[model samples]
Target: MFWRLLSTICSLTSCLNAVRVPGYDYFDDSYYYELKNLLEAPESLHGARGDHPREVNGWGPGLELGQVSGVSVDLEGRPVIFHRGPNVWNFKSFNATHHYQGEDGPIAEDPVLILNPDNGKVVRSWGGGRFLLPHGITVDHHGNTWLTDVALHQVFKFPAEAKAPDLTLGEAKVPGSDDTHLCKPTSVAVAKDGDFFVADGYCNSRILRFAPDGKLKEKFGHFGGEWSDSGLYVPHGVALDEARDTLCVADRENRRVVCIRAGLHHHTFGTPVRTLHPASRARVFDVAIHNGVLVGVSGTAEEGNAGGFTADLSSGEMLGEWGPLQGFRNPHAIAISGDGSALYVAEIGPNRIWKFTVGKTFLPTKM
Candidate 1:
C-alpha cells in the first residue's frame, strides 16, 4: 500500500511540474541558429561600402573604434547596446553622415541599438536629436529609458513609447552653463524611490544625484587617487545595491571599484571596503552587480584586445576571468541575464554583442 501511495504522489507531482513550466517549442532553435550564422558572416550583416558591418564596424569606427558604453536587456528579453563614436567629423572619412544633420556641424555618433548576442539585427534605434554623444543608458523601474550624453553634458529621460526623447531634465536649465551642465556623464542608476544617480565621468569625475522630479539633490566625488575616497579619476559605470543600500561606482582610471553608503553627505564619502584589480594593466570599463558578485569588463586603450572578469562584491576577492570568446574585441559593457546564468557583452570595436551561457547542472561534464 505504501509503495502504491508513493507512486501516485510521484505521478501527481510530475503532472504539476509539467503544468507549471512552459515548453520550449515557442523558442524555435532553427531561428536562433540561423541568426547566429548571419552574425558570424560579416557580409550579411554589414551594409554596402558605406554599409554598417553587422557583426563588427557596422556603425563605423572603421571596425577599429573602441567605445561601448552601456548594455542592457529590454522588457521583451532583447539585448540593447550603446556606444559613442569619437566625433562626427571623424565619420566623414568613412562617408558616414549623421542620421540627424545640422549646419552648426554634426553631433558625435549617437547611440546605436543592436539585438542580443549572435543576432546582428538592427532593432529600432533613435537618439540623434536627443544626444550629442550618448555615453550610457539604463531602463528605470517605470519602464522609462534614461541616457547620459557626455558631450552634451546632460542626462535625458525618455518615455518607453517615445520615438524621439523628450527631455525630462537637463536641457537648457542644467545648473552649469548650457554646455557645462554635465561633466561627461557616463553611467546611470535608478533607485527604488525613482531617484537616479549619474556617474559624471571623463571630465568632471563626480557622481551627480537627482530626484525623480529632475532636481539635483547632491553630487559626490572629484578627481583624485585616494583610497575609499570621494575623488575619482574617470568614473565610468554606476550600480545601486538595493539590498545593501550602497552605491557602487566603477572608478575606471583608478583601476578599482568603489562603494559608498547611499544618502551619505557628498563630502563625507566613505572608505571603499572592496577593491577589484586585475593582474594586467587593463582598465576596468564597466561593472554590474549580480547575486552579490560584481562582474566587469576590462581592456586596454588600444583596439583588438578586451576581456571580462568577476569578483566578490562583499570581499573583493577575484573570482575568475574569461575572454577571447566569440571574437570579443574590446568588450566595454556587460549585462547578466535575470537568472544569472547568462552574460551579454558589448564589443565596441567590433560593433557586436556576444552571449555566454553557463552550463546547466543536468548537462554531462566533458571528459
Candidate 2:
C-alpha cells in the first residue's frame, strides 16, 4: 500500500514527496533510497563508463593497442586481451581496404596478452604468429582459453597457462562451408559437459556444434542460399546458458538476439524460444551473461548512435541502454567474470576495453 500510494502520488505530480506522509516509514529504513536513485536504477537496462581501462597502466604511454577484438577474464580475474600486435593503426585501417574474406596470412605480431587485473600491466603474452584476424576469446569452465580468427577461418583452444594452442578447428588458412571446415568463425561458447558451439560467421551463416573430442556433431542455419526457419542471419556471437540448456546467438544483421533450446547429446536445436531486440538496432556485436542477466554491446550504426544494454535473462526484453552520449563506440566483444560481478567490453574504434560492475537493482524485487 505504501509503494502504491507513492506511485500514484508520483504519477499525479511527477515527484515522490508530493504526497502526504502517512507515517515515518521512509525515514525508518536504514537504507535510505532517494526517489531519483530509484528512478535511475533500471529494471532492464545496463550501462558503464569507458574510462576504467585507461585509469590502469599499459593503456597509458606509447604502448600501442591495435583493434582490441576480444577480451576474457582468467582464473585470477585478470583481463586477457587479444590484439593485432603493435601496429595498431594498420589493423584498424585495413578493414577499409582489404576484405578479411579469403585472407591467408596471420597478423605479423603476437596478438595475445594477459594483463594484471589491478594495474592493467602486461603480465604475459604469446600467440604472435598464429591469428590473421583475432576475433573472440572465451575462458571455459576448465580454464582453457579459446579464441577465433576470422582471417584464418579457424578457432583455437589453448590449455590453461600454455603458450600454444592444443586444439584447433577448421583447416588452417582455408575457408569453406563444410562439416570439416569453418568460414570465418566469429565466437564460441562451451557447455558444462565440454561440448561447444561456434558461430560460423563472416563468410557463412551457420551454427556449428563440436563434441568434447573436437569432432563435428551437428551444424544448422542457411548460408544465403535461401532463408530457413532457423532464425539466424549473420550470427556473430554464441553463448550457452548451462543452467537452462539455452543457446543465445547474437544475430548481428538481424539486429536481435535469438535464444534456442539445445540438447547436447541430441545435437539439435530443440525449438526457438525468444528473440531479444535492442532499441537502437545497431549491430549487436557480442553478449555475456552475469547474475542471470543478459549484457550486450551494440556498436554505433551509420547514424552514429551506440550503447551497451542489459535485458531480461529469460525474455530478452530491453532493460536499459547507454548511448553515444555515454561514450560507447565500436564495441565488439564482451565477457563477464565467473562470479557474475564484473563485465568487460572490448571496443575496436578506440582500441580499448571498459569494465562494469553487475548489481541486482535491475531485477524485480520479491514481494
Candidate 3:
C-alpha cells in the first residue's frame, strides 16, 4: 500500500527505490546469489569446466587490444587474434543496419596480432592499414591465415610470413551478390582437399564454395525461411570437418549450429544433417571443431559475458558450458589448441582474450 501511494505521487524511476527491495543490491543480494549458485550447482555440471581469472600481465602495453573479432591457433600452437584496434565497440548492436566503419573508412590500426598463450604477451603483429574491418581469422593446414572483413566485404588468404595476401576474394570495399562479390563475409572453412567454404554473412545469408585455386565452384544456403530447419538467418562462423567431409555453420540469429556434408569429388553441398540448439537461447556467434568436439561461443558484440559451450558433433548433445562466472563477455571468436589441451576465447565487449584449460575428460569420442 505504501509503495502504491508513492507511485501515485511520484515518478516510477524516482519512487521505485523507496520501496524496500532485497537481493537487488551490490553488497548483499549479489553475494547471496553467488553463494547460492556455488552451494546448489550440481557437481557434474560445475565440474565440467574451470578457468583462471583474468590475468593482470599478458597483453603488453604496445598492443592496444580493441574489439577482438576472431582467434585461432597457428601451426606452431600460438594464438592469433584479429581485432579492430583501439576503438573497441564500434557497432552499436548486432542487428544494426550499418556497421560503424568511420566516415572516411576503417581506422588506422593493426588488425592482425599473434599473442603468446603462456603470458598473453604480443609475440608479433601485422596487417596494419589494410583491413577495413577484421572480423574472422582461421589458420589452415598449410600454415596460412584466412581472414574476413565485414566492412570491406572481402576475404583474404595470407601465406605464412607474407605481408601481401597470396589470394584475395571479393573486390576491395565492394559489396555484391555475384560469384565474384561478397556481402559482409564472416568466416572461412578450409577443407583437407583444398576446397574452402565462406559464410557470407551480415547483409547476405549464403555460403560460397571455392576450389583450391580460388575458383568459385558452388553456393548454398538462403536467408530466413525457417528457424527449425536448414535455412540460415545469419551465418557468422564456419568450420570444416576434413575427416568427415562435413561443414559446420553458426547460424547466429537462428540460435543454432547447422552441420552439412560436402561432396568433395562432386563439389556440391549435401543436405543439412543436424541442427544443434543450446538449452538456452543464444546468439550463436563462432564455432571451432576439434577432435569431433564442437566448441561454440554464444553472445553478441554489444552485451558482455554470455558464455561458451561444447557439444558432440556426432550426436549433437551439449557436453558442458562456462561463462559469466568464468569471465567471458561477448565471446566473439574461439579456438582450440593443436593438441586440444587449451581453449582460447576472444571477447569483444571487454576487448580481451581468455585462456581456459580443456578438461581431460572432454574428449569428443568419450563424451
Candidate with top TM-score is 3
TM-score of each: 0.67, 0.76, 0.79
lDDT of each: 0.60, 0.70, 0.75
After superposition, candidate 1 runs with Cα above 4 Å error? 1-68, 84-120, 164-168, 171-180, 226-228, 264-271, 301-305, 326-328, 359-367
lDDT of 3: 0.75
Tens digit of lDDT per residue, candidate 1, span 46-163? 2111222112222222232326567776666666666655443233321121122223333444465746443446566656544555568777666677877654556778778676
RMSD (CA, Å), each prediction: 14.0, 8.9, 9.6
Structural RMSD, model 3: 9.6
Question: Which candidate do you rate higher for lDDT, 1 or 2?
Answer: 2
Tens-digit lDDT string for candidate 3 (265-319): 4434856768887655688999988777788888653454276777777777777
Q: Pairing residues by index, what is the TM-score of model 1?
A: 0.67
Better of 2 and 3 by lDDT: 3
Candidate 3 backbone collisions, by pair: 58-120, 305-329
Candidate 1 structure lDDT: 0.60
Q: Give the per-residue Cα lDDT of candidate 3 at 204.
A: 78
- True-structure Cα RMSD, model 1: 14.0
In model 1, what is the error at residue 5, expressed in angstroms?
Answer: 54
